[model samples]
Target chain A: MPELLSDAFEQVQRDVDAAFDAFLPVPQDTRARLVEAMRYAVIGGGKRVRPLLVCATAKLFGVDRDAAVAAGCAVEAIHAYSLIHDDLPCMDDDDLRHGKPTLHKVYDEATAVLAGDCLHALAFDILTMPGTSSDPFVRAELVATLARASGHEGMAGGQMMDIVSDEEEYDLRQVTRLQQLKTGALLAASVEMGAVLGKVPPEGRTHLRAYARDIGLAFQIADDLLDVEGDEAKAGKALRKDEGQGKQTFVTLMGRDKARAQAKMLVDQAGEHLASYGNDAQVLVELAHFVVKRDH
Target chain B: MPELLSDAFEQVQRDVDAAFDAFLPVPQDTRARLVEAMRYAVIGGGKRVRPLLVCATAKLFGVDRDAAVAAGCAVEAIHAYSLIHDDLPCMDDDDLRHGKPTLHKVYDEATAVLAGDCLHALAFDILTMPGTSSDPFVRAELVATLARASGHEGMAGGQMMDIVSDEEEYDLRQVTRLQQLKTGALLAASVEMGAVLGKVPPEGRTHLRAYARDIGLAFQIADDLLDVEGDEAKAGKALRKDEGQGKQTFVTLMGRDKARAQAKMLVDQAGEHLASYGNDAQVLVELAHFVVKRDH
Candidate 1:
């Protein structure tokens, strides 16, 4: 099972990388700066969590795995764009992302911001391209899902909260609400998109939703755990930046030990959703474990 | 006809204003900053060219006028978002918008950036909400159109070219190419979306495209003309910022008289395309004239 999961993961990564490469625009002389910035932000290193969810969720439904791969790449483009904008000098003001200099840090903030804007548009372009989805309705749903997830009630809304809540003390409940929209909404959409695009039954979608929600929370908790316990070299972020920034986080809300346990419980629930799919979702299960177990 | 146009314009304005007021996110204490930035970027100013295009195009198909109004407001939201981001300290660094302090100037740059992000997402949200469109496919197409227009090949890409081409000399062909994507694409989408959502025939879409393309260029050229001839208070921008920045523009390439002639021809061609829609498209003709004839 472990070997099979590894193979699937490797294949998913290759497919996503190729799709992204194909979708990027040519960096002509006049537009070269913008294109270069976009390429730098997107091609920059990260786990590709959203893409993996898209592919894995589609694969579970036994549908067009290629469509899933394309969608996965598209979602990642949006994710990368968000990260680029979030790290601008004026926004989150981060100098680094995924352990490397942020796009603005590497290539001026204006380009970084515009590149992120382009990537957001590019995600929808990928989802709605002529051959990407044969069913117009499905294609439309794909657009709707992605747009909603990326917009006000989803990631953007969460970001607004994150910026405003910097100095405020929020209880775990409020923090979780923000995290659910900020981090978890897209994660849920990643899974839901795979299911819907693959034409999975409603029952299957419900289970996957549960699975994605658990994994999403678990992923954030694991991130907090890493911030507390991991290294600068491994995590590519300052080890205690969250604490130093006076930001609210799961680790700060629940003690370190409790956060770790919560992560484990959520991962366990994600696994429980996979029981009906059995070995078919082996990669997804391994991914859940990887989320909780990773140092970074 | 002028009185009727003014009446329709006023009615559209009230309805659109009401639409925005109805749909805007509540200014809760935590998210007040973001909400304020969004309201500032959207309310009280700008010509509403894109929104008017949406309204006129939808009117051609005899759809409920309110649907067009909703779409108009949504696209304006997107256009407004783009303007806010463009004026950010890291981007254009402009201090003023619509004769007032820019969003980033009034609020912090971080809030301004996030406001742009949130507004972009909100446009999609408005277009996709169940109330926005009766057909799910129409909803999807609206999402897809705005996304494509906003992405790498559209406004974002155009902005990139504008940034990179500042010092370089590009010929008329290259300049027009950049203008088409940067400004033309979204304008085209504005008209095309009305037709698409209204279920206008494919041939009608073709006609609308030609109309939109011509007027879009005309609008840009007229903008160039305004830079040369209009007052600073009226234009809400420092006159000749284009020349000062060493940017290429239509007025720069052709003399002011020639640019005006070119704009008039385009406006005439845009009006000609409405032959297919017959008397139903009077509003569209007025809109085309407004694009070329407006002072601000």
Candidate 2:
């Protein structure tokens, strides 16, 4: 059954990659560098955990495949854009991503900036396009959710906090809030968009939203744990970066054993949020466990 | 009357400023710096020319004043965000904007970058919100147009060309193309969004679009001339920036007299594009003439 879950994840990942490719082809002319950097950053990479949540949730509701794929790719675009910006010299200053030179290093800093900017625009562009949904209301909902998740009250706000968080100390509660805004917003939006695509009633989405929040917190704790214990080669990026950068991640504040226990407990609780759906929620339950279990 | 046009411009500027203030208030906590930077970048500055275009065009179709103002604010957000990024140390490295210290100089590089980024997201956030338009179709159209005009093929792509055009050496046609994308896209979108909000039929938009394109080009040409001959106090920023930077501009390449003549001719042609609408487009016509004749 775990193997079957792996199979489902891979299928969604491949489908999402195809969607990215179809929407974004490498430009052969003047704007090629920005286009190529965007394609390079988005394609052929990472765990695609957000896309999996979107696709799995959509499947539970029998939403159209194309709608699910479009939503998945929109979330993935936001994730990729954030990574590119995070790698900038003025930001995290990292030079490696997925074991390759970061976008700013591979391309010039200016191109890196524009590529990230364009990709952010592209996420909304893809979601609102006709392929995503026939109804404009649905498209607006997707656009609104994605924009809210990606913007000041969400990921960017979290990043601002992290920039200053290094200089000023914060308590566990503050750190948790930062993590929720920085990481949880997009993760929650991925599941939220799936329900949107499925036309889930406003009142009907409570369980799914609860499920997303639990796994989102668990996902961050898992990332913190992996940073401390993961193999660099398997992670496809730097590991154990918190201490070097003065970042007070969950592992640093809570210790590895406690963080690990907390992640597992959250995953179990996330699975329980789907009690109303019973067997229909099996993939989501597996995903909750997989989120904490995965090394990368 | 030119005097009447000037009075109308001030009116819309005040209204747009009020809209921006409503959407972006200064935050009080950890993220205060970013929110402050956004407010500073957006408020109390510029000619408010782009917002004028949105309001004037909407006036032609009698589009709701609130919708027009919302769309105007969205385009202004894109403009403010672009100015912030352009003033980055890696880009234009500007020290002054609107006679005030630039965002990066005021609040460090990282905060400036994120503030600009968040403002970009805030534009989409505002456009898709309920207050922007009651019809979701109108909201989606506004979002799609703004995203396209702001992203790779539009402002950002134009910016990428501007960064390298100094080294690569482009002709007048290339420069015009770059300026169209870099500066023209958002201006054109302002008018287009006004029409969209008014729900103009596809064919009905042709003249408005042609008018927008003509004025957009004229606006850039006027800007080039201002960089050569504008008063520092009136312009509220550095003048002669093009010459000090050694970049070839319309004034530099074509000579001031010729560029001035070209701008005047464009303004006339822009007015002619509104011939079908006659008196209804008087504001747009006056704005075109102002583009060529204004001191700043």
Candidate 3:
């Protein structure tokens, strides 16, 4: 990605953070614990990849940047909620995330669970705020899209598969299918949501989806690579923890080198989707690269 | 509270069971175990109160039954998910529900957690199906409304309060506030969604909100009353368990007689909201009575 585009992405991230920080319901004693948990989970620093997709996809289609920001933040809320719950004792049981304590580890398990639940609901609430979407029909479509991407056939199902797939052997195809649903589903939705915001042409929408899927897979592969490399500080959580847990991962199914090669190939395919847009997708191009190159 | 209306409510209950039974995705292996747990949690018979609200609201607005059935199903899915998660080992730790084994007790804790997560997502997925809502804007609104009602400001928050309120004394006002958000918010949404579906006037919508709110409180109050005099066979889970857990219940805060009197008052207020609709709202009237008078 170009330096200017990188700077622009950072600005968007800042704005998204500011919007969420400002708009969340005030601190009331009745819900003080829940409110605190939500704040911690949401504001805890991360790469903000999903929000970037929403911003970049909207910009690619020449829509108002302001319009995409709220929706973008909403998607991030869903992403944050998933992470919080995924790290819970009854779920993945991780003690750390993004180089910080997991929500459950910081607050109590009950608070973490409630925080996740609230965050998921808040995502839809933000997207449906009065005057957020230009048309009610469009707003509905966005809501439906986000819900499908986050729900049973999407993220939740993938999580179920991931849990069950642990200790089981699987080929690349099966692993890819699992990752697509678990990780790629929301990424695809993030890009598609931007297209919906801009009302992109059918062809453009299709290409954006193709781009999201390719990069989403690449992102997971890179994550596996980082885990194998023992990049504990950068990668966060316990390093190589997947192997110890017998979780079926790209690095476990495919050799580490092969996983890296596959990630490169996926990124290349994602880039091919942007050829149609020429230089308009500079941020997305950089994002694809960042997804693979980052140690964390 | 007419006899004919009560019969109509019973028919809706049957429809709810059939819908959940038919719509559950077939489980595969471990997933099957998890899905089965979800099915057991949802399929266990109840009053189907939320679904009834959806149907009744839709009918009030003159929307086609087919168009509104998805929304009805979606609300129940959410309600079921809340129950499953709430009954987990870390949460309520209940071993029974609807006179059967609870999800976590029947399945493993991890599976129970995932089942709840999937079911929660499933509710969103069902609501957002391609053709579920003809008007996309309405679909978005429904999604947003449900999220709010189900999230921090509504169900989740209510639960958090319930947990905290224990070990502390609370007056009737505080109890009312807690119950309003817990059960009342979603109940109000059920009526509002129906009105939204039927394209009712703003005044009519307000009336539905008032009706739902009043009945929702009455419903909870009656529930507390039931715990005081309930049988295990009729009430599903253990009765008086709330007091055993040191829960701050309405009956505990106020004498049982006072609680019953308050419930009756709320039921009367709920009935007044439907006075404008005459016989058209007979089912809702009966529902209000049923909520206050039911033993289980």
Candidate 4:
């Protein structure tokens, strides 16, 4: 990775962490157990790739940095909450995340559930906070956009499909549809929300959407690649479990070599969507490449 | 109940059910399993009291009935999601609700979690839908209000407290705070969202808030009283379980006679908040009384 791009990623990660730490309920609050669980899951963890996308996209249109961070944190909170829930015994039942005990393991199952639930609600609250924007209409747009991405036909719907995938055989199209819902939706929303924060008009949004859509798929393929042959220490998770589960993955169907080539193609294609923005969108162009190249 | 009040309550119930039927994802969708779980949990259960409260309060300010119903369903969706999560084996772990099998029992635990999470996201989606309001600010307020009521300081927080409640003894103030968060928050938001839809001014909101606050306690006490005294067939779930769990409840903390009396007093006090509205609020006043009177 280039120094400048790597530095930008670290900076956004720090910003998002600070935003999360500052916004979370006080440690001494009455419901501190759940709040503590929320903080544990969200802060000091993850790649912050989603927040980087928000920050990078918002930068393209000169949105205020703090407002963008607030928006970034909102998306990251949802991402974190989804991870916490997804790792539940009933779901993925993973024991570790970001190199630490998962929320349920650290705090018990009930706290984990409430922590995830509360964090989901807190994401909307953070977006609507005065710091995000002076205009409620803009906040409403963010809420509507994020909620749609997170709800049925989006992230949650996709998760359901993934669960059912364990029972059914799915062709490439079905797999793509499942991938689009399970992971792509929120990835798209992160970029879309940044555009919303920037007050970018409808036509301008299409460009960002196009960019998000490509990167989202590429990101997933990269994930599959990681699962097939990732260093668990670097990734902070159990890898190769997809193959162990006897599930079809990019590597399973298209072979690792082909999947790697496809991811590169997607990263390159994603960059084209940002062509009209030129110099203003350099960070986003860098991010598209980063998504496929990240070790974790 | 008065004849007119009973008829109004039935109308609200029907309106909420019809609204839910219209908004839920189609049963034939690719990921219909989760969506189907959401529909089963929401459409065929509860007294729709939260929705009715929203409709009744919005009617006070002459808001459009359908728009009010949209807001009503938004709160109901949140309520439904909370119930689904609360019934998880890690949480309340009940097998029945509203005379039907709980979601996790009917559909797998994973489906229940996703359905609950998805329904939660859908609540915000419905509030922002064009059908809810033409005003973006109102939609934003609705989003903010519902999110706040559902987050750490609200329903989710309350759920956490309930889980923790088993570990430690609680006094009156602690118990009051717990009840306020677990149950009071959403009930309060139901009325508050309706006021937002009706475009009621801040001062007018105070009265509605006062009514909600009083009724919130009364409602919980009524539930406790039902557990101790009411029929299981009509209530549609286990009763006296709070006692079995040795958890502190209004009944345990205050004693049944005192708890029952306090509930009646709260209902009467709730009615006092609406005195200024005269005949326009007659239904709300009667509804307050009915809450304490209902068997289920």
Provide per-model DockQ scores. Answer: 0.69, 0.77, 0.69, 0.84
Q: TM-score each candidate.
A: 0.95, 0.96, 0.96, 0.98
What share of the reference contacts survives in each candidate?
0.71, 0.64, 0.72, 0.84
* Candidate 2 colliding pairs: none
Q: Could you give the candidate ranking by lDDT, starting with the highest?
A: 4, 2, 1, 3
What value does the lDDT take at residue B69 in candidate 3? 72
Per-residue CA lDDT of candidate 4, range A186-286, in tens? 99999998889889887869888999999999999999999978899999988889877888777787898999999999999999988999978888898
Instruction: Give the poorly placed runs of model 4, Cα more than 4 Å off.
Output: A27-30, B27-29
Q: List model 4 lDDT by residue over B1-296, tens digit each.
A: 89878898789888888888888847564688887888998886788889888999999999999999999998999999999999999998999899899999999899999999999999999989988999988999899999999999799988888888878798888888899989999999999988999998778799899999999999999998999999999999888888888888998999999999999999999999999999999988998999999987
Candidate 3 CAPRI assessment class? medium
Index of the highest-TM-score prediction: 4
Which regions in candidate 1 have their CA more than 4 angstroms from the true location? A27-29, A201-204, B27-29
lDDT of each: 0.81, 0.87, 0.81, 0.89
Query: Every prediction's TM-score for the first chain?
Result: 0.95, 0.96, 0.95, 0.97
* Model 3 chain A lowest lDDT segment of ten: A21-30
Question: What lDDT, from 0 to 1, does candidate 4 have?
Answer: 0.89
- lDDT per residue (tens digit) for residues A127-190 in model 2: 8798899999999999999889988889998889888987878888888998998999999999
lDDT of 3 by residue, A1-296 (tens): 56866786688769787878875765565788898888887774777888889988888767777778888888888899889888888777889888899988888887887788888888887878764577776676677778888876677778877887865676778788878988999999999989988887567687788899999899999988877785778777778777788777898888888888999998988988889899888778888988998877
Q: Name the better of 2 and 4 by lDDT.
A: 4
**Could you give the CAPRI-style class of model 4?**
high
